[model samples]
Target: MPISQDRPFEIIVLGPPVSGKGTQAKLLAKTFDIPHVSTGQILHSIKDDIANPLAQKVAEFINAGSLVPDELVNQLVADRIKKDDCVNGFILDGYPRTLSQAQAIDTAVKLDYVFLVNVSDETIIERISGRRVCKNGHVWHIKYSPPKTETVCDDCGEPLFLRDDDKSAVVKNRLEIFHQNMAPIIEFYERAGILIRIDGEKHIEEVFQQFVRHMIYDLRNKVNRSSGGSPSGTATI
Candidate 1:
């Protein structure tokens, strides 16, 4: 559907770790003045509201370092998208992992697009493994944004160490698991003909621009086809 004020832009940004989908989602949400509905952030925020029973249950699972059940997650997401901020639509960062979850979302709202920020395994490994952080949680990539001092935080002079999760082996394992879970979800959206893949191994701004160009191009084509080949003058994003 052509994005308009009346029709909300229900979008999903999908990609493996370090694919920059989160960054692109944030950009799209900000540019479109919509909410970035990240399930991970939603789960984390719910932990603070100890009075709500749902929040309490979610906190228990989070605090115990266990994944929340899919049913609970689906319910949480359903409730989240009903909020006023999501009326104009929202960018979903990481909710529908399983086919069941995707179908659940389908019943709630029609997704405009699922943008896959495509990056090679080698690039993902390189991008993730080069990450370093300090005690204060300041992050820097050794290759992209190194600190003034080697192996140290610029702000506090604390030694920066590689996070266990950012290690090469751990990243590889995460990629394997992500693909296994994401394959069917990708296929589902692809079959529905809303999956848009864009190269993400470029500069962050370039990646965002590429996504926007694809969206505008495809949306204009759609409008043209629906309007019997004579596109409107305002056929722009």
Candidate 2:
């Protein structure tokens, strides 16, 4: 459905590290004319705002090589959702990494849907392990998307290196941490009855089709029933 004029749409997209949640969320937000609010982007947006005390605090933590604690993250999200653009609705790509953050979100905004892009652990490993990066942030997967040169980025002509975090051992540890942190948050949404599962191992277009099947097609049906819009009138283009 198109973003409603008054209420709009607020969606939360979740997935593991290599699951393409960010990619899909950006596309969906663009298709529906809404903001794609990612926590990482939010942090970066504020990091240079020296006058904001919270931004100062967040910047210090990053400069010191420390993670921004959950309380600050929650506060940032709560404040972000109240902005004027978000009044129409927005797609939240990242945030609520813990149960505490999820609870904080409960008091912050009413979400329309929470979509979990589900991919197998094996798929995650393959997707993340075959990776290479450059100083300019050009990333490539050796098997699927190799650079023109073995040791240089095609886009920037910069030397490519194996990111320490993209190494096999580090990928496994990251996946483990993901499961440990995401399990409770996933269950929290499941119990709330707004969680929808999107199979993410398929081709990108196929995965997005599945996402729209629930997010747009399903919501359209609900809107039709509630407002007397014909159920048959709302067809996927």
Poorly placed runs, candidate 2 (over 4 Å) = 1-6, 133-138, 147-161, 227-237
Top model number, TM-score = 1
Candidate 1 overall Cα lDDT vs. reference?
Answer: 0.85
How many backbone clashes does every candidate have?
0, 0
Among residues 3 or more apart in sequence or in different chains, the pairs in candidate 2 whose N, CA or C atoms overlap within 3 Å are: none
lDDT of 2 by residue, 107-163 (tens): 666678898999988888888878889898888988899888778899989898987
lDDT of 1 by residue, 193-213 (tens): 888888988899999997788
TM-score to native of every candidate shown: 0.87, 0.84
